[model samples]
Target chain A: MMEFLQQRLTDLELFGWDEYINYWFFLAMMALFAFELIVMAFKKAVTWNLIGDSITNFITLFAYRFIGGLIYILFYLTAFFWVYENFSITQLPLTWMSLLGCILLADVIYYWEHRFMHVCGLGWATHTVHHSSPHFNISVAYRFGPLDGFFPFFFHLPLIMLGFHPFMVFLAEALVQLYQTALHTQMVKKLPRPIEYIMNTPSHHRVHHATNSKYIDKNYAGIFIIWDRMFGTFAEEDEKVKFGVYPRINSVNPFTVFFHGFTKLGKQLWEAPSWSYRFQLLIRPPIWAWEQEQKRKREAAAAEAKASP
Target chain B: MNFFVSALSTILLGLVVGFALSLQKAEPPTEFEKYSSANMDFATMSEVGYAMAAFGRESTADYFELKDYQEYVQLAQNDHAKALSASDSPQVAASEAQASKAEAPTMQLAQVEHPAKPKAKPSLKDWPKSVIGIQRSTELINVEKVWQEFASNSALSDQLDSYTVSVFAIYSDFNSDYSRATISIGYDKPSMKGEQQLIPKGKIETLLKPSNYGNNALLNAWQDIDYSKAVKAVVERRDYTQNSELTSLFVIYQ
Candidate 1:
């Protein structure tokens, strides 16, 4: 019986690491959906619009998981593993304390990475899709862009080289992700004050998703709220938060949802007056690109007006 | 054999369960079209209000905090009333009446000969004596339209009926290569603060570039000058890429 079980475990190895992680992640996703349905039965918050948004999100997530396998091999194995094997300061035993320390370190790295994603133009192009949905629900949690998965792993590479096993670092990240999945709903309002103060609750996450002036570019944390508080990106939920991006995307097309920001960036890159301006368009804060493009259009129109007569 | 059967059964069970979960539809698919940018008409909607909240930091005026959509509508009405009253002031009314009379000759000439070239430049002989600060030159562009265009993206125009719109231009004093111009449109009565320095320098040429129509460019046909007040529009020209210093101003009051 033991030999037979061992053989079955080997069969699972045919799918590789991403599938192994995804198999369990898939089950967790299903459980979250089930819980969401149960909450919907009693709460009127679950609308048809949310469901459709969720379906599109599910499709995106499924495709990401499938393609992410290749990304994992190409970028993760070649680059991350090389760093971990060659430059690890020292090996820490896979003990409980080491796991806790790794989670704490990984959470801090995530905070910075998440903040950069919101603040930078190129980063926003990849990350904004997650916040594109106006509706905040369980399905919104699944709205992952393919590009998002490729770059964020670099943030955690430090942890792998600091003597934490790469798998353990990934485990911490997955745990953070699972916690974040629960933060996507409006069903749970403010938790207890201490819990709310210390942890990244739904309230804090809602502020993160909001387009309100006070809320924009605030509250970027993964598992803990301390990082935001320490870093000054923390914003309290003062005003009624409006969800989704500003100058919001107006199309229901999945392609538009996925690629509108990239298209805007691409156009600016082509029309930019100089290489420096083009580089600025790519790497500057998202608002800087938007303002520059607007200035360019205004100048062009003004030129046309002058040329007419 | 028992372990093999158990493993196979677990795999089969997970697949069936996962498929079943996937089949769970989200009631009626969510309506996301309303959120699409195509359906959202920002042009027609008020954008200046949002602009004021978002970009009004540089302005010396007070920022009105709007709590909700209702407050926005209420404030918009209040601002419109303020503007109407400001325009109705005796001085403005007198200037406007005089402006209407002054605008007739140019309109008639535009219709008969050319719309672009009408009337000789206003006589700068009465130009105020220059003291020290940036020089000034005032010109009346025309008197045909009075409208406001929001300068920034994502402004709440409806609630922002009372905000200012600035227009900038460039002028060469026949010395430097590049220069800038600024024209401001607002409910505050226009003032020619620097009207004294309308003295035209050596071979002055107003370079009408494509960038002149930008938010800082004036679209109004005329400007009404109140000489006592700090001129609402600060028009300046500067060296290429040099910090734009307000050197010359052309304010035409109607």
Candidate 2:
């Protein structure tokens, strides 16, 4: 059993290690909820904001983790058996430089995947579920769309083959995630200016969820803020940014939350005027669709008024 | 008042949880905890020492394909020590004299060839030699295939008229001395029937190849096994020559 497990641990890389940390982290998350329920007693409404969101989101995330881990183990095992035995794909140099390169490249991909979830149409579909509840707190941070499971992390096969020990990579990814989880709470509002500049913050994440113009679509970082800043995706939360999207999907059904993006993707593609519009509907910014529809409505109103007058 | 009560209740619950976790800290498997990596710091013997204590029903996976059926042949408990000694037990020497030169009981020969083959034991000066010989290939039986032929012809045991017993896959080189592994078989007892039985280590036959195994490329996907299953700890042990082929061994352990 130890032999079997050692191979798995070595194979799980940092991912397994992150799970190691998460066991304790999961305990910590539960303890916070305990404090909220037993000490503050949920009646203290503000605590609910964090505790409520966190508990609900965490339960869902936990379910996904259980299911996802089970499924991925099958895939990872099949892949492991074939590749570890037959191939010498440890082609990537296992030096610190290579490790650094793999991790940074992964972060780069993650930053964009995250950014795309915020832009409207796509945002309304996938990212809005997170902002759906009328709550913002540590637990809210735990709430993620089930669709988020098909993340870039699973797609990182080439990176593993490139020389990253899947184990170490998993650890790095989990640490990055754990770090992100720490930022979800309203408890910590600000840090030193230098830290704020480089890291994603509750302040920045608050902005990303904000309906406020200045704040929307800003401050997307997993472990580093430089990705967002470099890509001009950074927005600072100044005014109290309203959470949740306008003309919200408004459904509490988690099923809706899961498929809202997919539904919107289909809707935008179908209702689009031209092939390019359709293509853009699928790929372009959310604002483009809104602008085009607004123009069409104004022209139709004018035509009606002129004929009647 | 409600807030205070909640806090007190939670603190109590936490204490209970801590107690439960602490209680679980005691158990035999704690040393084996964290299957991903056993605490090798406490390991003094070769890595195989870890395998002997391998436990828990969860560990059937580590066991190989269940060639499930097992049969035990009990010799007199007294012969156990004799059976364990190098094959030159007085019983064996007497048995060999009654047997053929080609089939001589060379169970204690120090040479690599069949001791019964009209050859003298090779001098230690000729050690490090690679000789191709067969290991015991089947399950253990008190009546060996070679011995069965002799005993039946001699009509030694009255039961031999209908006696059909299994042959243990052990190769005794009347010539060269060989190394051996010890094995233990568990005896499950029912409340009402079938007395508990003692099973000896079934001989696992190894094929001798001229090529010896190297330090680096020994076996693929082989895990460290528990080396201390010695029900009758044979002092014999075996290692490899320079270029041993991977499939050169076929074995059955009792």
Highest DockQ against the true fold, candidate: 2
> How do the residues A215-297 of candidate 2 rate in per-residue lDDT, one tens digit apiece?
76677678778767766667766676577666576555555654566676778788877897876675566777878889999
Which regions of candidate 1 deviate over 4 angstroms?
Answer: A1-29, A35-48, A297-309, B1-254
* lDDT tens digits by residue: candidate 1, A54-153: 7878777776676676787677745765676789765544433445566676677777778778777788887888888887777788887757787777
Using TM-score as the measure, the top candidate is 2
Off by over 4 Å in 2: A1-9, A12-15, A33-43, A46-59, A66-102, A119-124, A153-158, A273-276, B1-254
User: What is the C-alpha lDDT profile of model 1 across B1-254, one tens digit per residue?
Assistant: 65345335534543443343233322321111011111224331123223323443221012112122123233334444554776643333233333333332211111111111112222234232231122223232321122113122122222233222122332223212113222222211123232223322332222222121212223331133343433223233211111111112453221
Candidate 1 docks at the CAPRI level of: incorrect
Candidate 1 structure, TM-score to reference = 0.49
Error of 1 at A220 (Å): 0.5
The global C-alpha lDDT for each of the candidates, from Candidate 1 onward, is 0.53, 0.45
lDDT at B101 for candidate 2?
26
Query: Which digits, one per residue and each the tens of the lDDT, describe model 2 over residues B1-254?
Result: 65345335534543443333233222232111222222223232112222322332223212211111000011122233443574543454333323322231111111111111111222223222122222232332332453334223321222222211111122322122223222221111122122222332355333322222222222320222223322222211232111111212223244
Question: Candidate 2, chain A: TM-score?
Answer: 0.76
